[model samples]
Target: MAPNLSQAIERIDAAHSEDPTKVDIDGEPTPYELIYAKKMSKFLELHTPNPDPLLATAARAQHFRRWEVPRDSYPRTKPGYFAWRTFLKKRQADQVRQLCLDCNYSEAEADKVAALVAKEDLKKGEGKGDADAQIIEDVACLVFLDDQFDEFEKGHDEEKIIGILQKTWVKMGKRGQDLALQMDLSDRAKELVGKALAG
Candidate 1:
């Protein structure tokens, strides 16, 4: 990594280290968002050959100060869920944009990283879109599936889980889908994914 990129990632990790939520990692209590940010970087590195510095930074900062906006703050309805997600995307992007600028990235570069963090112009269906943005989306989806899906599935009903899986499948590009297929998910998660793909 370039010096600037390494410094930016360190700054992002410093922010993540403050997350109040803790999870066990190898018998040590670790900050949840810190773990998530690391997973995002690892997935992007593993998937994107010679990943862009901006994309790597965006991935590292994807959930920048996420715990500040708790999900339960919004209503449990679908519209509320969408609103919360929309608000979070903007908030995180804005925060990371400023962070990038503080790290000495040019304004254009910071804006690009913010746009990638916001997932602007991702390839939703078949039409062409920004390759870097798509790669960021793929990394995020891969991280969620690999790290969060099991606990996430336990909370939601089977129908909801399958629906989320299907939507997740649609958001991913081909590379993400193939990578997801290869993940070593538990039997129940595999079953849910199979049912989702079948539909």
Candidate 2:
């Protein structure tokens, strides 16, 4: 990685390290967002042959300070959910953009990372965005599926789990789907994914 990109990722990790939520990682209590950021970077590395620096930075900062914007802060209704998500995308993008600038990245480069974080380059449906944007989306979906799906499904009804899996499946391209199939998911998760696909 270039020096600026390395510095950018370091800065993002520093921000992630402040998340108050903790998760057990190999018996060590680690900040949840820091683990999440690392997972994003790992998934992106697997999905893309050679990931761009801006895209890598965007991946690392995808959920930057996400705990500060709790979902419960908004109403539980669908419109409220959309509003919250929209706000988060904009807020994360703007903050990460400024961080990139602080790392000496050019305005255009920083803006590209912000756009990736905001998902502005995506169109509705799979394979409908620019390569970089689509890869970023894929990386995110991959991380969620690989790292969060097991626990996430435990909290929802089967119908809800299947519904969420279906929605997540559509967001991925062929490469992502292929990688997902190869993941070492638990048997239950595989069954849920099968049901989601069959539905």
**Winning model by lDDT:** 1
Candidate 1 lDDT score relative to the true structure: 0.91
TM-score of each: 0.94, 0.95
TM-score of 1: 0.94
Backbone clashes in candidate 1 total: 0
Question: In candidate 1, which residue ranges exceed 4 Å CA deviation?
Answer: 1-3
Local lDDT at 64 for model 2: 83
The CA lDDT at 73 in model 2 is 100
What pairs collide in candidate 2?
A: none
Worst 10 residues of 2 by lDDT: 122-131
